[model samples]
Structure formats: C-alpha cells, structure tokens
Target: MVHSSDVCQCESFIRYEKTFGVTHFYSIEGVPRTGPTNVTILNITKHSALVKWTEIAAEDRLGFLQGYRISYTDSSRKKSPAVTLNASVTSYHLTGLKEKTTYRVQISGFTNAGEGPLTLSQPFSTPKYDKGELEGFVIGVCFSMTLILVFAPLTCCLVIKR
Candidate 1:
C-alpha cells in the first residue's frame, strides 16, 4: 500500500495500485506558469536608449529565460525591426539614428514558451542639433579677434620704429 504523504515532491502527482500486491507510483504533468512581467523603457538618447524592468514570474527555477524584444516607431510612423536581447540584459543600445527625431519604444519580456505584453513609453524626441547660424556667427567673431591680435602688435611696433 502507498500512503498519500509518501508521494515525492519531484513527482507532480503520483498514482498507486494494489492489484498485484505491489504498488507503483507514476508522475503527472504540471501546468506551466507565466513568464516575467512589468517591462518598461528607462531612458532614451540621440543614438541609444536604456530599458529597465522587473522579472515577476517564471515557469520553473531550472527553466531558462530566453530574452526580450524591443520595437520602435519613428516620427514618420514607420515601425522598425524588432531587436532581440538576452534574458539577463535589462538595457540595450540603439545606435545609428538621426538627431532630433521622435520615437516611440516598447519592450516585451520573453522566455522559451512565449513573450509578455509590450510596455510602451511616451512619445520622445532626440536631442536637437546645434544651431548652425549661431555657431557660424560665434566662429566668425573668434576669427576676427584672432586676426586683430595678430596684426595689432606688428602695427604698434611699426609705429614705434617710425
């Protein structure tokens, strides 16, 4: 005879019989649990962004988390390709992007089974470029001052010699 409490924790559920004066235990399957949750974008910049999130659940401790998927849309409302990352990777760098462009980013956590829902960020724009006209004026003023400094001393020396 097999007692109920005698069942092993390794076995989800056990079944036993005494038809042949002997008992046999069989393991049953268990339901799979949900993956991680609460994904969010932490920060963004001109050429890259930083994403942060928390892991809420896992199917099993022995199971491996696959990665995350990052999706984004540009100012033109065109969606970009999905970027895949490792499970342990909470943040990522998105490079080679135009300056002063608006973007919407979302993050989704994933495991071997499936991916969690996407967490999106508010509409954000990259840092604006330096103003060209203002920069040019500043450069012109500096150049004029440098030329004056170069000629002023020679002009004074010539006046003294005369």
Candidate 2:
C-alpha cells in the first residue's frame, strides 16, 4: 500500500507491504527549491569566456548551497560535462574553445534538494585572434630587408669588398 500527501504543493510518499509488513517514508528536506537567475556572459576571448549568474532566492535556499552546474556545446555539437563550482562562486571562466565559433551554454543552481531547472540557453562566440602591431612590424621589416638586399649588391659592385 502507498499513501501520498501534498503539503505546500510538495509531495510526500508512504509505502507499506502486506507480505513483508514494512513501511517507508520519503519527503523533501531543507534545500534550494528554485533555480538561479540572470545568467550572462562576459569578457569573451578567442579561447575563453567568463560567465556570471545571480544567486538563488534566499528563502528558497534552506541554508547552505552545494554549488552550481554549467553545461555547454559548441558548433561541432559536442557537449561538455557539467562544470561544478562552490556555492560562493558566481563567475566561472570556460576555456579551450575554437576561435570564431559560437557556443551554446546553460546553467543551473543546486543544493541538498537537487539540481533545479536550467537557465534559458545563451550563445556566445569567440572572436578571432588579432596580431595588429606585430603584423605591421613584420611588413616594415620585410620591406627594409628587401631594400638592403637590392642596394647592398649594387653598392658592392661599385665599391668592391677588396
């Protein structure tokens, strides 16, 4: 036999068996009842990004939080394992990403209860790496080297190294 009751919309279950004559009870305990909010991406780079999110509501969270879990997928459709972090942390840095590719990300808050609903999905793209000043320097050096190679031989023929 099984008996169920609803308290504050939370479910409680009781089970009993006639043959074995045993009873068991299960119910929710102190834990976070809702998911975190306001997940955002910041400080994007060619191979990494910083993610931030709001904390769970105070009342909904019983006392201490376990942590958070983050999941991400890239243009290649490869899924990443949920990254876990301490409860005190709100920002996380994701690394090892392909340049100029968009990654889809989702986050969820967890506590003693379990993982809550995932946040609304968000997509962010890594920008291409820039070698601005280095590129210009290389071009200038090449031009100077070419000029030396051309002028040095002509000058050498006129004013012999003898």
Candidate 3:
C-alpha cells in the first residue's frame, strides 16, 4: 500500500518508508538494463556513413521498446542532433557528413520509461573526395572510345575498297 507521500514525482517508481524511518525504492516500469550491442559504423562515401546494430535482448528491455537513438560527432567535438529510429530499424544511412573526417557514433534504446544506457562510441573515418581523378578517368575513356569508333569503320571501308 502506498501512502500520500510515498509516491515520487515519477510515477513509475515509488519510495516507501519502513521501520527506523528508512526509505526503499521500487520500480513499476523498469528501463533497459543495457544498451544495444554489435554496433558498427561503415563509411559508404565521403559525405555519408552507414550505421547498424543489434537490438537489445528481450530480457534486458524491461519496458516496451520505442526505438533507438543515434548520436554522432566529428573529431572536432561539434555536437549534432541525434537521430531517432523506430524499433524495427537495424540499419541507417547517415548523410550530410563532412568529407575526410573522423566521427564517433553511439547507440542506445528507449522505451516509455526513458532512454537506456548508451553503448561505447565507435569511431569511423570518411574518405577524401578527389574529383579530378574521377573526371580524368571518365574523359580518357570517352576520348579513347570516340577514337576507336571513328577509326574502326574507316579502316574497314579502306580495306574493302582495296
């Protein structure tokens, strides 16, 4: 039985008084015991990265699973808004990232009670963008193809007329 003063501001938990004026806490809706595991961050491009992780085990999720929160920041320590995904999501593509930068990402699950603990941050690095190299390769291929197309037909005609 709960008394008037026994209930705390957060209804999920209650504080009750015992003998000798001692207080004890009890949980009605427990949060997850641990964060998600097997978190992986892979850089897919200079401006984006892919994040994937396994969900928290059923036993650890003490309440209804709402979703997962992903927090990421670059080496400069600039804070970015966290992305929240539904519980069904296991993979996410993070865009608008800086090129050739190192970033750290952390993941955690949440429920009606609140967010659970965050996993250890994992580091990933984006590759540098070099447009010149790609452009040069494309231009070279187009030029070689144009030359072959022009010369091959003319050579066949000349040999047939001989």
- Residue-wise C-alpha lDDT for candidate 3, range 1-162, written one tens digit per residue: 112234235644436523345343335556778889999886467889899999999778877778999999899999689999999999899999988898999989998889999999999888776446678888999999999999999999999999
Candidate 3 lDDT score at position 54: 93
Per-candidate alpha-carbon RMSD to the true structure: 9.8, 11.7, 11.2
State the lDDT of candidate 1 residue by residue for 1-162, as single tens digits.
112243354543445422345343224322223433455544455665555666535533123456777788889988889999887776667766667898887766665546766664546677654346558988999999999999999999999999
Model 1: runs farther than 4 Å from truth? 1-45, 56-64, 130-162
TM-score of candidate 2 against the unseen true structure: 0.63
Ranking by TM-score: 3, 2, 1
Q: Write the per-residue lDDT of candidate 2 for residues 45-131, one digit (tens) a residue.
A: 888999999988766565457888899999898998879998888889999888889999998777676777777888999887634
> What TM-score quantifies how close candidate 1 is to the native fold?
0.53
Write down the TM-score of every candidate.
0.53, 0.63, 0.65
Clashing residue pairs, backbone N/CA/C < 3 A, model 2:
none
**Which is the leading candidate under lDDT?**
3
The worst-scoring run of ten residues by lDDT in candidate 3 lies at: 1-10
Our tally of clashes for model 1 stands at: 0
